[model samples]
Target: MEELIYFHDHALVILTLITIIVFYGLISIITNTFTNRFLLESHHIETIWTVIPAIILIFLALPSLRLLYIMDELNDPHLTIKAIGHQWYWSYEYTDYQDLEFDSYMVPTQDLNPGQPRLLEVDNRLVAPTHSPVRVLTTSADVLHSWAIPALGLKMDAVPGRLNQLSFLTPRSGVFYGQCSEICGANHSFMPIVLESVPLNVFEDWASSLME
Candidate 1:
């Protein structure tokens, strides 16, 4: 995730520089009355323009490819969870445990607690330990749905009869929210994903409670 963010910022800087240079050239052309009667395209300027863009693209592509490789590399996850997307909710199963599973539904506005954010809160949150590699296997029950968490840099399509996987780790304990990115049905907007990160001991206790 850190690499992804850094690449994004680097691309943005390159884009900003290009935009500024283009605008500056435009303004110079508009404001200045410098026009030669025998003006012709210079090979020097053509080569520079072409080479500079190629160099910029190389800079962008290298990082992008590296990020893709990193994302694709499957690590030895400490825990694995399978997320099954439903019509308007999500069901999760901790594959490591025998019977630790539950359905996660969006909390209606009327049922929200004092500090909970509306439309983003869920009845049950997917919990995991911080500083651990957790893999999520995503698939749909009826239709297409996207299991996504922007904060964790995860977005995988939940296709029927197919399982997609993504891995992530939270550096600190906190709550992260996400929503279905695909347009499935009428209640697609209501289905939300909430992930609660806790310490390893807390996560173990929570899992034990569910098992008991």
Candidate 2:
């Protein structure tokens, strides 16, 4: 996620620089009284314009391609979880643990706690330990759905009968919220995703409690 944010900032800086330069050039042309017809046909100016843009594109493409490759590369995961999308809810399974599975349904507006967010609270949250590479496998039991969390820079489609994978490592413990990005059906807006990151020992205790 940090890498994703850094790349976004890098691209934004480049885009801002390009926009300023182009705007300045446009202002200069509009304000200038001198008309040089020969300058319009100058191969030197044409080459400069073409080469500069190409160079800028290379700068953008190199980092973009690098990130792409990194995202596609799956490392050895410390833990694995499977998230199955239903019509209006999500079910999760801790692959490393026997019988550690549960269904997460959104808490209705009337059932929400005083400080809880409306349409975002869930009955159960997908939990994992902090600072560990956790692999998430996603698929749908019904129609198409998407599991996306912007803070984690994670998004993957959940297609029927086809599992998709992504992984993340959170440096700190916190609760992250997300929603189903794909429009599946009538209650599409109800399904929400909540992930809780805790310490390794705390996570173990929680898991053990569930198993018992």
Candidate 3:
């Protein structure tokens, strides 16, 4: 996510520079002394058009390549979680722990508690620790579905018989939400993905309580 933010900020700066340069060129052309032939053709015009664009292209490509590299770089994960999408729900497995697995069903709007988000609440939320490297594996049991979280900048396809993986880290404790991006079935709209991040001690306590 930091890489994405950097790319976005760099793009804004480049856009501002381009805008200023264009306005300056337009004003200079208007204020300059020009004959009919000077307006038609100039030794500087052709060279400027070609050379300036090449330089701009190189500048744009540098950041684009950097972003791609950042996206593909995979680091050693401290925890691994596997998520399998069902017809209208999701199942999760904590592979790093003692066979901890559960199904997460979306909470019905009628059953939602006060201050709870409608259609976004789930019966079970995947919980992890903050400031830790976490890897997520995705697959589908039936139809196609997409596991995505916009805030974390993660979007992976859940294809049948194939596994896709993505790694992310949350520096702070918060609840993140997402939904099935693919058209699965009639109840697709009801299915949502919820994740909770807490301190390492809190997460350990929560995991231990499940066994008790």
Output the TM-score of candidate 1.
0.92
Q: Tens digits of per-residue lDDT for model 1 on 1-212? A: 78889998999999999999999988878987546544436677778988999999999999999999888777799999999999999999999999999999999999999999999999999999999999999999999999999988999999999999898889999999999999999999999999999999999999999999
lDDT of the structure predicted as candidate 1: 0.93
How well is each residue in 1-212 modelled by candidate 3, as lDDT tens digits? Answer: 77888888888888899999889978877987344687459878889888997998888889989878766666888889999999999999999889688999999889999988999999999998999999899999998998988888878889999999888899999999999888888987878999999999999998888766
Q: How much lDDT does each candidate structure score?
A: 0.93, 0.94, 0.89
Looking at candidate 3, the ten consecutive residues that score lowest on lDDT are 31-40
Residues 1-212, model 2: lDDT tens digits: 78888799999999999999989988878998437888878999899999999999999999999998878777889999999999999999999999999999999999998989999889999999999999999999999999989899999999999989998999999999999999999999899999999999999999999999
All candidates: CA RMSD in angstroms? 1.9, 1.4, 2.3
Per-structure clash totals for the candidates: 0, 0, 0
Off by over 4 Å in 1: 31-40
Pull out the clashing pairs in model 3.
Answer: none
